[model samples]
Target: MNEVAQAAAAPGLAVKRNWLAFGTGVGIEIGAADLRVSVVRLRPSGARLLGEKTIEGFRHRPAAQWGAEYNAFLRTLGAAHLAATVLLPRRELTVRTLPMAGVAEKDLASAIGFQLDSLHPYAEEDAVPAWARLKG
Candidate 1:
């Protein structure tokens, strides 16, 4: 059997599956002063850029207006039933890499929560944290 089939059969072995299968996908980015959208087509071989557009005046507009504009833009692309991912501006995110040694998977969340205030600018109550372990 192939590696994929073997991994799927073994319950103890965790298999990483491609969440974004071969198809068109929309990536939306909401920036402080602009909104950008990109349509990409993914195949087993590679990815192809289908379309991309950026609009200004995000800082001056309200959330509802931006939502409407985004809907209209998606309509223009006819992006129906396509996988989509929205990315927030980098400025709005606080990213950190914490070195965790000898920590179990189940206890990582609580461990990070304990150090949230020190790792990020916001207090523990105000911050949302997510982490992934790096493979060597």
Candidate 2:
């Protein structure tokens, strides 16, 4: 990841063109009581697991402290460019699939977006809804 940084600072995964050659990324999961991280590199030959880390009682620890440890691990593995993708606990996420048989491609965004509030429990201000159009 960028700085042995906590995934909270860089919550989403961003791909770089150069990554097509390296295929390196870090996966971070925020669990109920701890945080887990994994760094992997994919090559034509196969995928290699470079490193893994877990921090217990993550909710109670200071961000800076655990974040430093996070950075240190990636620094040791020389994973400076890997984007950290953080996965929140299942309880924090809401999944809803809408059947839009007639929604035009251009209207897909607005169609799903308008229903975001009803899809999630969070208040209007707190909700950060994201969607994708799935194909069968």
User: Highest TM-score among the candidates is held by which one?
Assistant: 2
State the lDDT of candidate 2 residue by residue for 2-75, as single tens digits: 57565435544333323454588899999889889999988656689999999788789999998888888999
Please write out the lDDT profile of model 1 over residues 6-86, one tens digit for every residue.
878886443233433477899988877787889888775668887887867977878788767777777777785576798
Top lDDT prediction, candidate number:
2
Which window of 10 residues has the lowest lDDT sum in candidate 2?
A: 11-20
Which pairs of residues collide in model 1? none
Alpha-carbon shift of residue 38 in model 1 (angstroms): 2.5
TM-score for each model: 0.58, 0.60
Question: What is each predicted model's overall lDDT from 0 to 1?
Answer: 0.77, 0.82
